[model samples]
Target: MTAQQPAGGAAIPQRPAVDFGRRYITFETPRFAGRTPRRTMIVCAALALVILGAGLASLTLGAYEVSFGAVIRAIFDPASDPDARQVVFEWRLPRVLFAVLCGAALALSGGIFQSLTRNPLGSPDIIGFGVGAQFGVTLVMIVLELNTYLWKASGALVGGLLTALLVYALASKGGTSAFRLIIVGIGVSAGLGALTSWILITVSVEKAMMAATWGAGSIASLGFDQLAPAALVFAVILVLTLPLTRRLPVLEMGDDAAAALGIDAGRTRFAAVVLGVALIALVTAAAGPISFIALAAPQISQRLTRSNSPMGTLPVMLTGAALVVVSDAVAQLATVPVGVVTVSVGGIYLAWLLAAQYARRA
Candidate 1:
């Protein structure tokens, strides 16, 4: 085709306008101009206070009604009072610690996925990985006849990894749209949820009851031995995840931009997904699929820090820990599962989020 001639008699070339629909949206790590470090310090300190207050409430407000000083004394000097030590150190302490650890893990996992997918709804629990892990645990307990903590953990890890791989593959086939990924993940989660229920129903009555209880997501009746391995795994994963997540805000700028910044967007995403899945699996294996903490914690942290980016990892972790500890304490009032409380609270928050989004659009 011949080029068109303009009024000046020179040939003019026409080019199509570039579309910036998805790639235009970019989020960077939260930064401050002058008082960055100070603000961060204050936020961190505030988050710590929240976590500490939750822990104190968990330790003090229970059936025994131990005082805060008594709880502290029992933790540091268990030999001073046998009854106090028994209540704080032996009975309640392990459960409380597990709740905190699991909550942190779930929140971190959620943060990683949300950053990777660049969607607020990209959470392990929401995307079916949590249910997948629960299915694995159920299978091990009922079908495989292995009820050990290690076996359950292995099952959960395998299940979660498989689900992640499946979801990523399906999403990438169409070039990895975040909305598509979430839709696919929801379908996968529904299937897995059905399977979990089927497994529960087919098992013997006692076994079914046991599976149901665990599936309800409780930190109750746990011992130090159960929490120890999970804690070690969480610490190792945290060490690995923290460094990798330094690239997350960059990744949020789209693959091309991220590559321009010398970040291997693909590799970083894979590592993040792996680490996030591992976190979810470990926590699910340790304390079942505690619902909504993963879905809610990152958003809460983001709002609390008033940052647009998902780089507030520590804040998210602390918020998550505080949430679960507080929820567990509330659950203690009715002696119900912490998962129940989280789901109820999360449902209300989810409703609010939807309403806010609609209002903004309007």
Candidate 2:
């Protein structure tokens, strides 16, 4: 293309047209290079603010009723009121932080599976992984009589990975079909759930009650003792999974295409399943299986950012954190488990998603 001549007989340079639809901010460096949509960045910022607001509300609105100013002072100033310090720091702060971490972990796990299966319903909760983890914890507490955090975490991780393998084996007859995977997952989830129920009934009432309460998923009794170790494990798993996040999107292009691009499809899927199960196990060990945050957060983030693909891990994590913190605050007011609140909300979201999917098909 030639530059246009103006009345002055001089050529005027023409600038390339910018795509106003989805503006992206690109970065390149020796160590790393990537681009993110401006909308996604804004959405992430807003979600972060939501988490902050919800966390503050959780700290202030408990039965103890610490004022906002006192909450701030208790966190920052050592000389703050003793009662306020204990209430905010010892009682509430740990729970709030745990909620954030647990929510982010579950959401990340959900995003990994959803992207791998290339389906909206491909979450750990839907696919029996969460139930498998829960069953593991129950076995450790009830059958094996090993109720330590380490044993329960190990059980949950192993159970979740085994469930994932079973589902994959059942679904991969000719090739792994997304619809077949969901169906197989639902079946596996049902079987594990029934086994969990049988285990609960066979145990002593006190043990059963304790396991049941934990199974309902409450962050209420957790404090620094539980939070410290969980936080460390979460940090390690997150760092290990960071590189795999970029590879997952490539696998969505199909095994052959991914291989053509020098990506190992089978290895990526295996690693994602292991790491994703590890994430579920982390949360289940700390809090029992806190339901539905995993199922809802990634899809919600996708819709908010107007993205076709659910590869926006950061935004999904932020959305999950906000959901969990807010839900826990509500649960406190209702004197119920946070899991109950999440299930209620997530059920509604799941129904809507199904209806939307059916509508599109029709």
Candidate 3:
């Protein structure tokens, strides 16, 4: 590769193309430039298709038994079977859309933390953030007796941020390391779990039951009332997160190296933690603490794309959305909470991941 002489008679520096045995497409502009693996693009496309197919499949699974055609018509045709339209639009569509939003939000949060910690196990669910959010929402519902979306969202956001700060403070004792963070987080999560349990036991049976159901994490009862606000918050948090995507990978190179590159490691990490917690809070507020999608989605996407970079946010979110949509559909068939389905599947994934990590160490 060589610099090309332009019409102005000046040599325009060109980035030399390097082949690394894998095909990649490059793009450049005055404001931005990057290369993407072909495999990543394909995997992302496939995941998007999976989310679409699974979401459509989910729409037809309930007791009302809307046919595939009916589902499509309900969405597009105003005059198509008023009853079917009601079932799909008013009832089922919200749940399906919520599933996608929650899944994507969780996955993005997980990716942010994992990238920050540079460890596969660094997820909001594992770090007690989800538990903290659950605890907050529990207090609001059981003690404050406020069940509105705003109250729950506020509780979740505050609780998750507090928990994240505690974990970070504990882990940062001698400068935070991935292993220390995970260990401290696990301890915090366990203590919170015990406290939540104690609170449940002391509360009235009705309140306890309601808390337990929400804690188990189900989207069955959620409709537009919750979805609209959640979606709005998600959009805002996502915009804040976009700038971090590029900076996060730089921080992965370590604080000194990132500093040399003009990236503020401390500020970036703080923003990542806050935005990540907000993402978790958003999901926990509406759907309760749906677990494991955050833990598994990013890793699954990384493996599917075979990319080392944690910047592949879109594919990770799609993977999560697909996972939740499919799992929700399965939950409908079993008449169980979506959280139960994810926990069952995610537990297996966790086991496999731990085994792999152990084997590598051994």
**CA lDDT scores, all candidates in order:** 0.84, 0.91, 0.91
In order, how many clashes per candidate? Answer: 0, 0, 0
Alpha-carbon TM-score of each model against the true structure: 0.87, 0.94, 0.93
The runs of at least 3 residues in candidate 3 whose Cα sits more than 4 Å from the true structure, single-residue gaps closed, are 1-17, 26-35
Off by over 4 Å in 1: 1-36, 76-79
The residue pairs in collision within model 1 are: none
Backbone collision tally, model 3: 0
lDDT of 3 by residue, 1-362 (tens): 58899888989889977767788879999999998888888998898898889888888988898999999998899989999999988989899999999999999999999999998999988989999999889888888999988999999999999999999999999987999999999999999999899999998999999999999999999999888888988999989899988899889889999999999888998999999999998999899989999999999998899878555688988988999999999999999999999999999999999999999999
Better of 1 and 2 by TM-score: 2
Best to worst by TM-score, what's the order? 2, 3, 1
Give the distance in Å from residue 248's predicted Cα in candidate 3 to where it truly belongs. Answer: 0.9
lDDT of 1 by residue, 1-362 (tens): 44788888889777767763322223455683332434545666887887778777788867787998898888788467789889888888898788889888999998998888888778887788888788888888899999888999899989998988887787778477988999989999999999888877877899999888888898887889988888998989999997766699888888898899899877898889889989988888878889888888999888877767665678888889989988998998878999899999999987887688688879
Whole-model lDDT, candidate 3?
Answer: 0.91
Looking at model 1, how many pairs of residues clash?
0
| Candidate 2 error regions (>4 Å) | 1-15, 18-20, 26-34
